[model samples]
Target: MALHLYALAILMGAIMSIYIPMISQSARVMGAAVMGNVPFFFVAFVTSVVIALVSGQRGDSFRKIADVPPWLFLAGVMSAGIILGATFLVPRIGTGALFVLLVTGQILAGLAINQFGLLGVPAQPMTLSIAAGAVLVIAGAALVTFGAVT
Candidate 1:
């Protein structure tokens, strides 16, 4: 099940890679990158509602919402900030550079998260192999962002 979820995450990542560029274009057309979130969240909200209803868990979900600590809600704020930043940066830095940097950042954060088991996630002590992989990813990001075009 974990492998299946990982595969799905990879697929979703690919879709998001394309989606951000489209959002950047839409932001260009709409005259503000932040404006892109209006339609984005509208669709997200509708889809989430439909999913909750379809799962017959809408009431349960709503009830459980209060069980969540207030700090957990910051995830939504972080998500909005990410989308808004991507919408703004994609146009200026190009998708390749932006995603390279984003992925690099994600890898670094994941390493720390796994290292300390932060946010209730299971701890995975950082190993030499993992550290090397991160170093390579950072190097690749540098190449993508700073390398000269031929």
Candidate 2:
């Protein structure tokens, strides 16, 4: 059941990877009309609040913020950068291209992160199969970026 749900979650993420940029492109236009050059921040602020409300209530009520390493705190900062970058780039490159590039980057970075155990995670040595899979993903991304999506 857990594995099924995880697969469903990945499917949902794939759907959102397409859907979100369309909404964000519209929001970017709205933000430009209402605010100035930094509409993505406004959109990000609202998104953060929604995410916090959904996530914050589910966990232990008395978690200690101070116990968390300061380095781990950068996740939110990184999320903001991703959101803002997507908002800026999706309109310029189109969603297919943007996500192809993004996924390619993610796979590459994930491979490195897993291999090195960077950011304090348990290191998993990169195997030949993993490298082959990563290469396949890159090739797929290249096709998605360059080929017609229809």
Each model's lDDT comes to 0.90, 0.75
Clashes of 2: 0
After superposition on all CA atoms, what RMSD does each candidate show versus the true structure? 1.7, 4.5
lDDT of 2 at 71: 85
Model 1 segments more than 4 A misplaced:
1-3
- Which has the greatest lDDT? 1
> What pairs collide in candidate 1?
none
Residues 1-150, candidate 2: write the lDDT tens digits. 599999998998788696557556665667752232245456767887688777865345326566888988799788666766776777778888888888899898998898899977799998899999999999999998987757
lDDT accuracy of residue 61 in candidate 1: 80
Model 2: colliding residue pairs: none
Measured with C-alpha atoms, the lDDT of residue 88 in candidate 2 is: 75
TM-score of every candidate relative to the true structure: 0.91, 0.71
